[model samples]
Target: MNKILLGGLAALALVAGIAPAAAQTVEFTVINNSSYDLHYFYTTPSNEDHWGDDLLGDSGVLEAGYQATATIGDGSDQCLYDFKFVMDNGAELIEPEIDICQLSSYTIND
Candidate 1:
């Protein structure tokens, strides 16, 4: 992840009013350990059916063995969120109730 993404996360956290010492310190690290390069990253409310904007925006690329980290919400207090990782080949992995608060990192295994 680049400094631009980190700066964006900081802004998001502040807008959401997440305390500095809380879960906001921990980032959601998306790992692409598969053979394919993941192109899009989405995180939305667990109950929502539609995937929200790409979390990666213009910096959306998690190559094999690499990880991209982003802080999505306020300490939020809510633990559930959906994650979608998509590849160029039209393959995708969607995970629900990711418990973003408790997870230090999330991995998409081979």
Candidate 2:
């Protein structure tokens, strides 16, 4: 009886120690309405240790009035990330700020 109880307690402890593997997939649609060709960069917000290196680096030359779609990851975060778009001439086009959108709020559960 003692061995059985200990085994059950160990099993419970093992189960409790394991965290649930929550993942998220994000799809991004980028539109370039500016006259100049735009270059974009993506990075995880949590990546404070390495800024550009941690970025997904979805760089591209987007012509004016052109649109592109980018799909990224199975992340463990609660929401999706709104990738930061930077132009080749060192200008940012996103309004308000860089980390603006709340993509995680509308994330789809898998």
Candidate 3:
């Protein structure tokens, strides 16, 4: 039965080697320094077809000179996303393929 024992040990080692690394969540802040209030903030997985719901829900508009903490991490193991800022006058600026884990904050200014 030594062959069986060796096979089991090898299987265990392979499983350990293929196990995923530790999870991480990046908490970043969004600062609004422009002249208009931030009406909505959107974020979605970089690979998705649509943007998720407004990240600023219920917190009200983010006025100029204010900041909000935007936590960026996927429980589904995604690490990249697109971020968008919508202003009060229906203008929007989008930054695509943002590695949210690499940012501490973002600013929208004139």
RMSD of each: 3.6, 16.8, 16.3
Q: lDDT tens string, model 2, 1-110?
A: 22432343344344434534554444455455666555554444443322322122333355556554434442434342334556656776432222323332211111
Sort the predicted structures by TM-score, highest score first. Answer: 1, 3, 2
Give residue 91's lDDT in candidate 2 (0 to 100). Answer: 71
lDDT of 2: 0.41
lDDT of 1: 0.69
lDDT for residue 31 in candidate 2, whole number 0-100: 52
Candidate-wise lDDT, in order:
0.69, 0.41, 0.68
Question: Which consecutive 10 residues in model 3 have the weakest lDDT in total?
Answer: 1-10
User: In angstroms, how far off is 99's CA in candidate 1?
Assistant: 1.0
Better lDDT candidate (2, 3): 3
lDDT of 3 by residue, 1-110 (tens): 22432343344344434445654555677788899988777888888878866656544577877776665433435667888888889999998988776788888997
Clashes of each: 0, 2, 0
- By TM-score, how accurate is candidate 3? 0.71
Candidate 3: clashing residue pairs, number: 0
Instruction: Write candidate 1's Cα lDDT for 54-83 as tens digits.
Output: 766666566788776776753434578888
**After superposition, candidate 1 runs with Cα above 4 Å error:** 1-26, 74-77
